[model samples]
Target: MAVSFLSTVPNLLPIVPVNASITSAPRYPTLGATVRCSKIEADADNEERFKRRSILTCFGATVGLELVRSSGTFVEMAEAADLIQRRQRSEFQSSIKDTLYKAIKENPDVIPSLLTLALNDIMTYDKASKTGGPNGSIRLSSEISRPENKGLVGALNLVEEAKKEIDSNSKGGPISYSDLIQYAAQSAIKQTFLASAIRKCGGNVEKGNLLYTAYGSNGQWGLFERNFGRADTQEPDPEGRVPQWDKASVQEMKDKFSAVGFGPRQLAVMSAFLGPDQTATETLLATDPEVLPWVQKYQRSRETVSETDYEVDLITTLTKLSGLGQQINYEAYTYPVKKVDFSKLKL
Candidate 1:
């Protein structure tokens, strides 16, 4: 039966035709038919893709190596730049300090005026709108001529002269009037501290200065001085902001101080800036029930040798007042100057 079945098959045959159609559908079930390419064409296409991928890989490796090499130098360069900036700032501040120190020595009368300039300028700050502050706007002719800012022109002139000299000596750009005004106030406060010590030392200026330095809070001025680089406003601030010291009532004074975010204690601590005498200021402010206690406390503290409470509060309050509505310029003293090499020049 097996031999008969084999004979009936006639002959053994290949499963596939010799000349199969290239466009024929797949024998098994498929989603779609496909176009078949010749072996040579497929090989060429793959070679082209490999060439592009190799080129891209080489380019990427070269860039990555460069970045890795440069990363080591970037930090060092940044540190060096920062050092230069700090050094320049220090030198700039020292120059100004020296010039002002000599100028102040020549004219000690300007001390009171200095504090007045800062006080009136800072008093223009309105907490609600955040419009004004110690921005040297008090230097304007219109502003200075106002009743609230009377007698400030002399102080303005003193700083203006210093500005001229400072500008001439500056390696960086000129110092703004805003920075000068606030810095002068800080210097004035230091002078006052020194003056007090000097008076205690039998009117010997040098001895007084030495004694004051030994009091251990001589550096309190740093609280105000460290926040440097203030900007000036071109136009004058609106009127009715500052207190009219000549005629302002106690309630009016309290109200004005309240507008600028100060309490009775702050008002009492800052009495010296309002007028020449703290005792007289306390007497006038003592009429108010709310402000009387602070006035009395500072008055008592003023009698002590150190006057620690008064000085500490004054410095802290003045620092806050000076910073009101100010946007500090971090690059104020970091200008890079080019030096001329005379030896290399032909002329």
Candidate 2:
């Protein structure tokens, strides 16, 4: 395991891979045109937006991680993740931006709170699934009031207030809290991304130039381009009934993360991935000391001058997770990934 990681990770640094195939592939530009990267390239000024949505490609993967644990089939997980992400409230993104920006400015001292808010809503408890003889009608706070949700108090408060504001000002009714949860994570990622880009580009990227970001394992790993038609009218998720985390072991973590389709390799990568960036993993490390080494590896790999391991696992995991998103897409669409022949093409 160590060798696989040590060897594979070093070569994968800088995350973003060049999709040279797309560029080199045969294609027409326009009338009497051959090909140029500009023909298919998106404008650089819009890079931030692309990064936001592309980061969102992880939405399905993250939500799906929980479903697979409860005996979920790939298609079932795909359906559920697709449904949840489709309904995400864009309003929550604003709050997320604020929270993550604060984290960037303040650093680890404030990271615990931000990470707590970002991760609390995503514990995989569903509202609609809370059915029994004695249970009352599921109100908005049903799951939010649960013991499992203790970590999410701040996130819940934020959403509750945001919902009320939206209801008061917007033409439409308030957005669903479930959707808002997904958006919170989305916003955090976007803010972190923009901040990182700014710092790397000398605090000011030119009007048209590359935004420094690793594309991860496979190029387009985090890019989800398909549309999801699942409606927002569906019921919220039922509460997730998971075991307590106290005294949990590394093997236990492996078993649990495996349910979400992650293997030791992924855990290895994710440890190095989530550990350094989010700093929220500190909450987990406090309870699960076994992951300390992996987290340390992530730190060294990311910050060390060697450049051998810098951000390798992060990019690798993102790319792999993007592939997982595509896998879910494949199942949800119930169609094969369409193969394109560049040789024969019109417009």
Candidate 3:
């Protein structure tokens, strides 16, 4: 029998709340001391460990920072950071960078491609959740604006603003807000993915050229697609649509996506596929030793731990327990799927 794509797993994974209340908190300086060593040995073994730890911290901080900064906004600093990191890591050939730059500059639609990807993923997830369907009178803007959304909200806002500009410039031509928001959201996703990739490669957001193609560059990821001409609606969706980050269970997450018309397969794929990015704060604290203590304290106050530390610790623990990187490998895999063409569908 073919695999059922819509069926939920019997034993769902528990949602570990990052921001739960803690009974006792460690002092900031003490927490910082836990991760920091006083002296650096120039020995081979120590050097190797130092390099690994540095790389891990860099990646973790970048992801955490991007998450915090981008939460609920569209202006993408993460994209800029991704490009810089990519360039530093030499992930793309110099020739490829040159080409991408040319394409972005010549084609205004290039940025929109990234936006579309981000939007579609969220929309797809939303659609998959039985509890968060489009027909339930939920507001798109409100849902996008939730605090849990973090960096995504800003990206959505950018989409809304861009749609207005397009409509106004069109001199009464049809442009939908939905289409624009979708595009922006997808772009944010692309940015996040690229940023995440950079962190994985031991780079940070300071580098700009690696994050985005310089305007008018060629050889980008794909061809530019035209907008479907959707307009924005000012109305915010009623409450109870977006899932609380702290309260979300695997089942609840699935239900939220189902409500938005997405399926179990898509949800599973997304869970595995989406690359993580850091918040701005995470990046700053990780790279600078002076700020590490403060960051730890702040996180503790919020009943959260450093996201970067968590990612590394979780991966390390799982690898040790399993004696294989299977869990890590699975989490790293993403679905190579194309964006949904809303223009072709009768919405």
Off by over 4 Å in 1: 1-72, 337-347
What is the C-alpha local distance difference test score of each model?
Answer: 0.73, 0.38, 0.35
lDDT of 1 by residue, 242-265 (tens): 987757888888888889888888
**Number of clashing pairs per prediction, in order:** 0, 12, 86
Poorest lDDT segment (10 consecutive residues) of candidate 2: 1-10
Q: What is the descending TM-score order? A: 1, 2, 3
lDDT ranking of the models: 1, 2, 3
* TM values, all candidates: 0.74, 0.40, 0.31
Candidate 3, residue 335: CA error in Å?
Answer: 37
Off by over 4 Å in 3: 1-153, 164-168, 171-174, 193-227, 231-238, 259-264, 272-347
Q: Which 10-residue window of candidate 1 scores lowest in summed lDDT? A: 1-10
Model 2: per-residue lDDT, tens digit, 44-69? 55444434343333333433533454
